[model samples]
Target: MDWKGRRQSGNIEDRRGVSPRGGNPFGRGGMRLPSGGMRVSGMSFKTIVFLGVIFLVLKLIGIDPLQILGADPGGVASEQSSPSSPRITEARKDEMTQFVATVLAETEDVWNGIMKSQGLEYPEPTLVLFSGAVRSACGNASAATGPFYCPGDQKLYIDLSFYDELAQRFHASGDFAQAYVLAHEVGHHVQNLIGVLPKFNQMRSSMSQSEVNKMSIRVELQADCFAGIWGHFTAQKGLLESGDLEEALNAAQQIGDDTLQRRTQGYVVPESFNHGTSAQRKEWFARGFDSGRLAACDTFNNPV
Candidate 1:
């Protein structure tokens, strides 16, 4: 994928080094609040780095540092680290940050056109980049939960470090593969916007665990198809190179529930599967890519 020099989304929230609860990440005693003063103790170099990152993030989000440290907002006065604060230039220019913003911009462009063609408007979703853990309207999630789209918040959350695991563990390394992952989450956002997610949630309220899991498979497969729709657009625009499709397919296969279960437990339980099998995922994506129509992505009406 030739994504360089491309438009980048302005909806990215770079919360990379902030703690999950928007507090000190260096554990207890690393930072302390004493009456009206902030105290620092036993801070290592890495801890200081994290503090700098947090300070930068808080300012970016417009949260007063003194208020966060338990001081009265009106009574406190200090030269705190902020966006204008000089220490944050390097962190803001991270390569992964640019890559995510670029991919999100592509999704926004493609989906906006797609939705408009159907006489609908696409409300672009925000993408939140975080490290370790983050909170969303849906819930708090750790990095172990993987990248996800929280419909409740209408946002996408990701830990860029997942790219390292995509290469090292999943063995699916390529720019397109990473794009596919991000697009798949954005696909969920599409589902949310179109009422598919709400209907699914309503249906799941009366469903058994197994039945809910089965419905989840359909949802997951449709997102895969939606991602393929994005790929179809990119390919037509000559942005996708040879082997890019293969990389995406390989990623889909590698992350399939069956593949993951077998790799982890040495066996697979079909009924326990939430996402589709490897073959099913690849097939649905191909269906969308080949047809380039939302009608082809009816994973719920037809057998997936």
Candidate 2:
């Protein structure tokens, strides 16, 4: 992982200090309203009827319901403000921020080159950095949900603190491990760009939950393979150390759905697994790394 003097991406949106009212950004707790507002406990049958009638009339007239309610549509309606959490120092946070930016720039370079070779334009996705919670087109997410890619927005959301948890709880330490997580999310963005996400979404209504979960495992494993493709390019650029590959492979194994479930819940549930097992993830990633070909990542057709 020789990332010194690498170019940093300007696509990072830092929203670490912003807070939401009511509940945490991840939508766990109930939002408390300000004074003079309708309280859930105070609402009676008559009040509910009156509000229902008002909403119906507003809908009939094509009026924006939120505006009719005299609410600040653009402002945070949750808690006012809280003291900032002091997990990482400002200097360390900045360093991690730059590291992510550099990795994103590398992914952009590799994907753009690969896409151009296939006569397709590659649209780079933004990486958003936040703390505590963040609002996304997909919905509100707390740091607890971990890093995720929102296909609707074509952006990656991450909280750097999760890296700490990855190291401490999952024992997946090393800078390369962190890079793999980012690369995996970027892989989802690639799927979105190449139409895989739309096809999967279309099948959701007809597929059972277990079937959909199997599809999700395929999707995740494909991302792992894409991350390995990135690693191949990075290695070609002479950026990899001797043990860097092992670090990444270890990370891939450590975060497998089965491994993670067993660690958290003391049991493994195969049908509920969205991400592939340790061996499948490592194998697909190694396939991509060895072949360095996008076609090698056809997890949908391969047995998992």
Candidate 3:
């Protein structure tokens, strides 16, 4: 991967230093006790009930008192920063952050051209960099949750430490593999733009758990295919080195639900597989790599 000195994305939100624990639990809501009881201090029982009534009334009218107070709900991580807040750590002395920005820029280039060819405008999604935990419009997540795309905010949340985990823990190491991860998440953003995710979210609630899992396999495999589509364009630019494609394929293989299940549990449950098996993932990615057309990456109708 000849990524050095390449164009970098400016759509990065760095929240590495912000503590997951914001402040004042009761400021938003009453304290949550260990025994599952609410504890409100400096207020009587009647006052607490009165406040609760007020909260309900505000909730019914779609107003949030906390927002009016200019504070995040539940004292969670916030986008707002202050001089008193924790200082954000600099981005890795120009290593991980630079690589991520370069890759994101490349994805933007590929997708922009493809979308324009289809007579559609591509809306670029922001990528967020966090350390331990971060908050999105969807919810809060820790680094252990891995990388994810939040349709609610049109942002991709990632903790760069996951790259090390990918290499050491998953045994799939390469710059291209890292790029594949980002591209896969960006593929989800593309799905969101094309209404695929909206349809899935709308229909999944009425589906059985097993049915949802099966559908999820299709969704994830399609993202893998989309990643490969990005790879195909990247290769045309003569950016891929020898074994670069294999690195991505191995990454797709290593993170497959079947492979992970076998690794962690020593057995595989086909019914519980949501992200497809190793062979399925690699196959879908290879399909997109071979044929860069959008029609080649459909995992919903055809076999995955």
Better of 2 and 3 by TM-score: 2
List candidate 3 stretches off by more than 4 Å. Answer: 21-93
Question: Model 3: per-residue lDDT, tens digit, 1-304?
Answer: 8899999999888898775644322122110101111122256789999999998999899999779768875454553444333444333435889999999999999999999999999999999898767777666666666788877778887888788778887888999999999998898888888887778887887899899889878888898899899999999999999999999999988988878888778999999987788899899999888898789999988977
Q: Tell me the whole-model lDDT of each prediction, alpha carbons only.
A: 0.80, 0.79, 0.80
By summed lDDT, the worst window of 10 consecutive residues in model 2 runs over 30-39
For candidate 1, give the lDDT of residue 3.
91
- Give candidate 2 misplaced runs (Cα > 4 Å): 20-88
Prediction 1 global C-alpha lDDT: 0.80
**Candidate 2: what lDDT?**
0.79
lDDT of 1 by residue, 1-304 (tens): 9898899999999887676654322111110000111122356899999999998999999987767797654432432524343344455447678988999999999999999999999999999998767777666666666788877778888877777778777888999999988998899899998988888877876889899889888988999999999989988988998899999999988888888888777999999988889899899888888888999999989988
TM-score of each: 0.77, 0.78, 0.77
- Which clashing pairs does model 3 show? none
lDDT of 2 by residue, 20-101 (tens): 3433332221111001111112467899999999989988999978875676655554123222333335668878999999
Colliding residue pairs in candidate 1: none
lDDT of model 3 at position 193: 86
What lDDT does candidate 3 reach at residue 278? 88
